[model samples]
Structures are given as structure tokens and as C-alpha cells.
Target: MLRFFFVLSMITTASVSTSGLAQSSSVQTAVDKNFLELETAVVEAGATPIASIDHARLAKAEGVEMPASRVLIFSDPEINTPILEENVRAGLDLPFRVLSFDQDDRPQIAYTDSQFLKVRHGLNDTQALNTFESKLLEVLNGLDAAPAPTSELFADYGVIELRSQRSVPEAVERLSTAVMGQDDTVWFGEIDFATEASQQGVALPDTVLLLFGGPAPGGVAMAGFPAIGLDAFCQKLLVYANEEGGSVVIFNDIAALAELHYGSSAEPHHGLNKRLTSTFRTAIE
Candidate 1:
């Protein structure tokens, strides 16, 4: 039996609720703000804005019509390091994100709640989680947006895990190379959770996260529902050490994400799920 430290059942189960807490919080802005304005807001809040994806523009270039939508990825090392020190898996949600989109002709913003992250990754640092959540909320409140009720967009997001014979670093390298080799995908970058934890004077097993996306398929999915980008846009694959002297790889289940954001009738974007599974399988082998 593989002694995975994290709860495999919790991650694999479909649409699991975070004990009644909404997975995300959304608000409608009183005034319209462009993508650049939103990005500036995040930067001015003391978080380092890492990247922004203009899903609407990307879809437009592909001949798909999508409302104005964008996702901003940002992080405050001071806030993130402490939480990561408690549970390295929290890296999966770090470099926090906010999604802005046009809904009913009104500009709206949505972000994952820090409480959701604490539950999703089984984090135990109450102080750190509270601090992170407070900072994020401060940024959203500054936008002059009327807060909407929290939403449980998905019952629970699903995760796919693959056991690898190689070490964590080796598996990460293999997966990164394989993902980058595909012409349809673009490699965004990576986050080294173990290293970040170490910098905070905490010892954690090797863990790394690779961010990449297939714009063609991802854009199509966003065209259907722009809000899905809040959770599923930039695909992430996590490689982490296990107690058995090997490593494990994990990523979001595209099919589950589609059903979570879209309805059960939704299908994985253009067979992208199958291709992603195949890529990870080969990388692990």
C-alpha cells in the first residue's frame, strides 16, 4: 500500500463540499475595470502579480466568442510561506488567483476562498490562513465591488494522481519536458513548495507544481463559461515525495472540472483530458 500522507479519498471524490463553506466568493463591481486596472489593483496591494490570462482575447483569436474575462495570478511570499510551511500541498492553491468577467453586462470578480484552500490541502495553520484570507479580501474590497453571497461553484473538484518510481525532482522534470514538448500547450512556469518551506525554516518533502495550458481547448471551454477559468484555466500538475521512497504526480481531473463548472452534460474540452492523462502516464513510466 502506498502511504500517501494526504487523503487520497478526499481528493478523488467528486464534488465534495468544504463542510458547507463556499468554494469561492464573487462580487459585482460598481464600476467597470479593465484587465490592466485589475492587475494594478493586485500589485498595489503588495502581492506580486505573476501572470494574467486574457481568456476572451485568446478565444476571439480562435474565432470563439467569450465575454471579457481574465485571471490574475499573484502571491505575497510573506503570506504564502507560513501557510506552505504547515502543509506543502497548499502550494497547489498558492500564487492566489482572481477571475474577472462580464456577467449580465456587469463586471464581476471571483476568487477562491482561503478557507477552501485550508480544507482542500488539509492545512492546520489557522493564523496563517486567516492572515492570507484577510489580505485577499482587502484587495477585493478596494475595488468598490458589492459582495455577493459565496458560491459553491463545484461540489468538489477532482484530482488525478499517478504513482511514479522516480524521485520527486525527476518526475517533475519528466512531466515538465513532456508537457512542454506538445505544440498545443504552453508552459507557464513552476513553483517549488519544498524550497519555499525551507526558506521559512520548515522542513518538507520535495514538492513541485508545474503550470501549463492548452489554449486551443481551454479557450473553447472558457467561451462556453468564462468563470471556469477561475479554477481550471492554467492546468497544474503536482509532484511530491511519498513515504515509500518514491514520488507521486497529481493534477485536476478535467472531466470533473467540466461537470463542476458546467453541468453533468459537459464533456472534457476537445479530448484534452485524454491527452493530459497520456502525457502524465508516459512521464511517470
Candidate 2:
């Protein structure tokens, strides 16, 4: 119980409601000030600020080079609880993200559509999910924007379909224990999608997002290649009903993510990548 409280405090402190809480980099981008302005603006929009990771500073400190970058994750638990009640895996996209970056002197801001997040995970509780989309747009409009982006979110994810030998709760308990059993630390948080949805006057299949990881493995990988941190901070165990109504888990393959982040299969990351894939397999099987 103490461990759970510590993890919550750790993540939340990095994303306080007040402005100026962000850990930023010295490298400036044209759009940098916009994000600073957004910190306050996002609050006015009624969302809970989660955390912000400055990839540029994080990478530079680890002896790697990256463009000026910042990623912000925010949520309105009041809004999310109702939706997540119906679709637990929605947590994957919960606490939506807003990103700012400078490339070749041009600063740009980007965000993922909550709808797109559901599509990638194969969730279809459209009405409930739309609330997440709308809330995200509400926050984004409070700031500034570039042209509408056509790119998909989580394009690097390699999903796996595993037949669940145990129920969602059983799987989660097993996986959580496995995580703590690891020599290095790992932390996870779970959400009850079905119950949350039922409370919202909707029905959804039993679904869950078992999100867990630690800074050690992902951080080491980031030191090896900082860009991967953008996508690899945490890996998820998505337990949901497939078309047949049987339970299965869908997750992002670490090896695939390494390949995507490195842009063309860097053999150097093969070792960590394999270990990552193995870890997920052990939890589910």
C-alpha cells in the first residue's frame, strides 16, 4: 500500500496543477513559449495535469542528442472515470498527450485524437469514447495549433493476441506480482472498465489496461537511444474481448518499438528488446 502511494506521488509531483512545475530544457524552440502559456490554459480548461517529460533535456543529460521536445499528459478524472467504467483499456489513451517540438527551427505542437487511440486498441464504445476526444480537443483549442495532422498515433505498436487462461482480475493479479518479483522495480496501475461504464449507463465487455514499467530498463534504453523514450516509458497489458467475446491481451511489442524509434532496425537494441518481449510473455502465460 505504501508503494502504491509512492508511485502516485512520484508521477503526480511531476505534473502539478500549478504552472512552472515542468522540468524543461535550455534549448528553445519557436513554439516553446506557447507550451508555457498552455500550462495555465490547460488548467483553465478543467483537466488534471498529469506529467510532462522534456525529451531534449532528458536525452542530453544521458549523453544523447535530440531535438527540442516536450510532452504533456493531462486528464479530467471526473470525465475519464465515467468513460473508463465502460472500457478499461481506454486507460491506454487516458490522460491524453500534447507534444511540442522544434525541427529545423520550426516549432510544432501535436496531439492524439482520443478516437484514434481507441481505434488502435480495437475498442468501439463510440459514444463514451467520444467524450475523451471532445475533452482533448477542448484542451488543445485552449492553446494554439499547426495544420491538422494526418499521422496516426501509436503507429509503432505491435499488438499481440494471447488467449487468457485466467480472468482479467486473475491475470492482473498474477502480472502485478510478477512485476514486483523482478529484481529491478516495476509499478502498475489498473482500472475497472466495465464497472465504470455501467455506472455511466452503458455496457462494455470486461476490459482492462495493466500498465507497468520502470525508469531503469526504459531509462537505460533511453540512454542508449533517447528517441525510444518518447514511446517506451511504459508497456501495457490490454485485456479485452475480441470479436468472439473471449478474453485476450494486446500490447505494444518492445522490439517493434525499438525498431520504430531507431528508424531502420538497429541491432544494438536487440538485447533489451528481447528481454522486454520476454517479460510480457511471462506475465500473460
Candidate 3:
């Protein structure tokens, strides 16, 4: 019995690599299916969904290595929701790609039409689209180089939205000037809930402030690669707020983490979480 068990274990081990990594095709298929499934659920839940794809896989499968970042944001509202459900169960994967830079000094993946098609179909193609793409690449590389948002940048054009019950002008004045260094700006709005609280009675404010930037009520901000953004933003907000009062409901749009690659809010790094908490502690105490 012992020899039989040992032989079985050996056979299993022989079929797997030492690193325990699944075959690239298997991993790729799994990821593609998972993302598609997630998209379907999100749409069925009545939320608008967007997908960001990595387009370097085609070249990689053909023995090429290239560095590319391409994300696709689209709306398929006209498609029946049931079609989406059928697609998920059928394991039909979206035509998408993956990107990575390698040590061989070549791009890990080659650019291909399938990848570009997703982007072309999704974008509005305004002249600014070119500028935006360039800016996004710069921001991603910058985060890899120096993981911290320039507060001064926020001081220049960043906006803040306060709750209706709170005084708006004062909040703006206090927050706008408080940001030091980078040229960031602040804009203000008020969220007003009606007495009856009907959806029509309550207007969703156009401007949202991520609490990680100022206060919690307006928008959620997060950390990590672009893929995990929503989760990271929500996590940091809860960490900073710590079940506190409503005074800090406004937010400043600190750049996404990809823009700030090196530091954190805690003492060792320059992140929004640490900076906001530090500011609050000094003010409250």
C-alpha cells in the first residue's frame, strides 16, 4: 500500500513543473474565462462594465517579447443581458491580450491587430485620445519609478465635493491651500438628500472626491496595478476613516497609484492613506 501511494505521488509530481506554475496556455485560458465571467455578472447586476486588456500575448506565443500597455473601455448596453450569460457558461473568451516586459531586451509580446482592434473599437478617437494614451503610459512608468502622487499636482486641478449639510466654501479654502508642493486644484459640490429620499429627489453629484484624497463620502480610491484599483481604493478608505465622523467626506483626486510608483502614505512611503491619516490626527488631537 505504501509503495502504491509513493508511486502515485511520483506520477503526479512528474506531470507538474517544479515551480508549480500551470502551463502558459492553461493559465491564460483560465484568466480569460475568469474575466469574462466577471464581466457578465457585473452587467447582469445592472452596472456598466469595462475591460482593460493586455495585448502582448500574441507576440509572446510567437516567441517575441515586447512592452506594451493597452486597456479597453467599452459599453455593450444594446446587447441582450442573456447573451452575456450564455457566453460565460459556454467558456467563450473575449478576444483580448496580455503584456509584459522581459529580460531579453525585446518586447515580451508583439503588437497585433486583435489587440489594437479592441482599443480602436472602444475609443472615441478625439484628438485628445492620442494625448491621453501617451499620458497613461507616462503615468504607469512613473509609478514604477516613484510610487507616490505629487500633492502639488492635486493642488493644481484636483476637485473636492462636500456634503450638502457641510459648509462648502470653508471646506474648499481649508483643503485647497492645505495641499503643499505640487500644483493641485480643488473643485467643490454638495450631495443633498431629500426628506423623502427618492432616487429622483437625490441627485448624484457629478464630482466625486476619493476619501483617500480628503474624505470618504464621495468616491472610492485604491492602490495597486490598474486591474485591482477598485478593491485597493475601498480598502484604504476604510483603513483611514476608522469608523469616524463625517467631517472629512470630501476627497481630492490624487493620481492613480500607477502614477505614483515608489512611496506610500505610511512613514516609510509617500501614499495618500498615510498622508491623510497624519493630517487628521494632528487636526483632531
Q: What lDDT, from 0 to 1, does candidate 1 have? A: 0.66
lDDT per residue for candidate 3 within 125-226, as digits (tens), equals: 344334333332332331221112234232212222223222323343344344322232112111111111223333211211211112121122221232
Better of 1 and 3 by lDDT: 1
Best by TM-score: 1
State the lDDT of candidate 2 residue by residue for 155-237, as single tens digits.
32455556756666666676678767876544544555555556656676776665555554555554444444434554556
Go through the candidates in order and give each one's C-alpha lDDT. Answer: 0.66, 0.56, 0.27
Error at 88, model 2, angstroms: 6.9
Model 1 per-residue lDDT tens digits across residues 1-285? 011111011111145366422222111222125455766777778876666766655555556665666777777767877876776666667767787776645676777777677666777788998899888886776563332123443222466778988998788878878888887676666777777667767777888877777667777766656666775658877788989878978777766655655554245453766778888999889
Error of 1 at 30 (Å): 10
* lDDT score at residue 265, model 2, on the 0-100 scale: 43
Give candidate 3's whole-model lDDT.
Answer: 0.27
For candidate 3, the 10 contiguous residues with the lowest summed lDDT are: 1-10
Q: How well does each candidate superpose onto the true structure, as a TM-score?
A: 0.79, 0.64, 0.26
